[model samples]
Target: MSTPALTLQGLGKSFGDVRALHDVDVTVESGTVHCVLGENGAGKSTLCNLVFGGYRPDAGRMLLGGNEFHPDSPAAAMAAGVAMVHQHFSLVTTMTVAENLLLTQHGLRMRRRDLTDRLDEIAQRYRLRVDLDQRVATMPVGARQKVEIVKALLREPSLILLDEPTGVLDPAEIDALIDTCRAVAADGTAVVLVTHKLGEVARVADAATVLRRGTVAGGGRMSKTSIAELLTAMVGRTAADLDPTVAATLGLDTAGPRAAARQRHSTALDATAPVLSVEGLCAERADGSTALAQARLAVRPGEIVGIAGVEGNGQSELVAILAGSASATGGTVTLDGTDITAARPATRTELGLGVVPEDRHRDGMVAGMTIAENLFLGQLGRFRRFGLLDRRAIGRAAQAELDRFDVRASGPWVRMGSLSGGNQQKVVLARELSATNLRCLVAAQPTRGLDIGAVDFVLTQLRRAATEGCGVLVVSSEVPELLALCDRVFVAYRGALTGPVETADLTAAQQISELMMGVAA
Candidate 1:
């Protein structure tokens, strides 16, 4: 064929003792989407980094359009017609979108009006709309992502790499992004999509490559390769090898039967009084700006309620209010008919409230502490005997929790930081759900940055918690997860709520999407 747009042969990279990628090979043809599929630590990031000239490969070589490509820096990569949109944004938050985009060009003076005009033209041409005057810090996550994409598109690169671009976008935005990618590819630019989201792969990929533990697992043309095969390659196991519940959740098994069963569960939940209720809730951010206003929702016992929104739209503040970490400026929070608006976090916990904070590393655990210590962080008094801590009892209890939760770690004695992201999440889930009197759970982005198996596990746990009669409030940007797990879904936009849409409704996705954009009530 014509020279491949990009090629990697026996690519290998390492970080001291960790082999991030090994003998990895991939090829991207002109005007096509090449997907790099893998789990959290599966070297997908390393491979992309190598292509972007962020890290020099430890072995093998890369070719760009029949030429040897060894870029020493990102600037060199850009000059060679390669662009990358990183998972975490690289924009200067204090700068305006136009200013940030202008910085990408070399030898360009700081001319705001000229840059804004150029940006507007590029945005119009690419069907990517971004306000040139908007500060990066003030824009929502989806808007920021558009800015990133537009930044890349403005470069007019022959090859563009997008890393987990959909993680922060709503469904409508995701569809728009996919369309944008297709349009870009249609223009003869090769695209590399690095994502763990299977739906995205199925929708956009022309060719797919699976990476498992730093090695190529399997890959083929997207149309010919079944999702089951891709899943097997990613996890190193067949569908039958997965936990049946997880398999069912991932839709590897028929969902028709599961839907009927869940419908019954939902019906039962509908008959009960709300276990947790928030009315006219208002909250302020750390900067004293209104983060939540007149937000109201209720979660019945044995039900899962979802708060869906784009990031920076008061979802975080609402979760904080429920978790008792932030004060509500105007509104009431009630748990099982008892007012908890004025209660401290510890008191809320005592009153049967469990919270899984969004930033697990910062709020969920003490990284330096042992798993046992982190597991029993707040309730260490139970392990006290004769005025001294009972280490043996604590260890034993911790091990049981770890085993029960299926947290894959060396042992309970291992430091919390030593476990993977998934395992750390399990510790949080186990601690929260296993509370003796847990009546309500506030889980914020519970599966963020987790692998497929880990996501399945977390969802299973949340469903199990609901089945055990715990009212769950899941605050997430992931629409699929919300749709799959929540009995009723509510959309949060600009500190307001619109929805309580039944999951069984055929128009749920569209309705939710409209609400998410603050378009429909």
Candidate 2:
């Protein structure tokens, strides 16, 4: 009751036609961790942007420490003791850790030794031990996250807001981050965490606020609520009836129509055939340092294999190699028993290998292109009537997949960039899965940036593909999704695959946490 650290009353905002945030209210007490829970595009981002001065409130009032505060810009917000660590990192990669740490200091002139010393001091105080002299670009994702957290802490803000901070972190790194946040709260600083991870919400939040469709759905103190209860509220149903959550979080709960369609146990996949195989896969930088070393993997027909590890543990390299976008120095790749490692990405796609690339905006789809064009891009061969680009055929095909995949959008003619993040991901899924002759599917971070409902749709499609005898190899940092979806999970550490373990015998979350830190269990 010592006056809330921050308060919002009648909070509202909107884009031109979309009401991003409606008459919302939030309160953060001093020295407590407040968790804002929502699916992607549920107005969580809009709320934080308004608070951080990234956008002006269309209508609202903000009070910081019992005083009115409206920051015109991010710098002004920072100066007013409001700092936000965005979902995406904002550090300058070419700069050293110490340099990034000291970037915001005013007209600071100090020796390198003094800078390192200051960095070490901050690191020790906050329990974050980064390599002070190392460049930000070379650090792992976990370390880079620490750099951002430390940067915010160095300013000594009374309130810190983090937006989906753990989206890129593995299970182990997530635990460490939670510890750090708790330590910060113990120091009397209010922390606001925005995330969709219900487990994290239960673990760290003193109180939880649920948002749905730009409005507060429900909220309660964590001690008085459970993750299941919170999830039910955010989704607007009992946990038992949640089709999307069950399918996405636990791999098509054996009670839905899709699951009931499985009249009997399916036959095990053949262990002999290699729908997709890689041997001695090696990629090197121009400096002769290897990014991948002797990497080997195989995906058989009708199996979902997951690659699990901390971010930057060579997952990106593997994705690039398999996508046919990067050259292998000394490796052979075979698809459907034919060598195709040296082929261009388009050639690989022609050979029945579909890739749902890592970054949806950058690699998966052309943001500037219309949805119709992106959907029929590599499959032009299927629509070549009279040897001309068949607009009518493409439109029919794109519209079909869009409806099948439940992509909510203006139409097939709309630009991919205009869609929401969740819908954008659905677009990727639709294009990748629409190939009738696809022999193997390589999905990297397939459900990244997607909400629970969209995640369920994508996973269901993948499972149905597996049911229909298509091989699947999924790579994700999210353990629960992998645990629930993949038939087998493979541990990767420092560019090495630790082989696969059957999902029946292992929990995805625990195994992933162990693999991330190289622990034996």
Candidate 1 lDDT trough over 10 residues, lowest sum: 249-258
Which residue pairs does candidate 1 place in steric collision? none
Q: Which tens-of-lDDT digit does each residue in 1-521 have in candidate 1?
A: 69999999999999878788999989999999988999877888889889999999999999999899999988889889999999878899999987788887654454767766767776666688888788898877778989898888777899999987876576678889999889899889999998887777888899999999999999888889988899989997887776543554355653542464357445655567788999999988867788988989988898888888877788888888888878888999999999999899999999999999988887889999999989898989999999999999999999999999999877899999877778999999999988999999999988776778788789888888888889989988776567666777898888888888776676776888888877896
Q: lDDT of model 1 at residue 208?
A: 92
Q: What is the C-alpha lDDT of each candidate?
A: 0.84, 0.79
Best by TM-score: 2
lDDT by residue (430-453, candidate 2, tens digit) is: 887887778899999887656676
Q: What's the CA RMSD for each of the models?
A: 3.8, 3.6
TM-score of each: 0.84, 0.89
Best by lDDT: 1
The lowest-lDDT stretch of 10 consecutive residues in candidate 2 is: 257-266
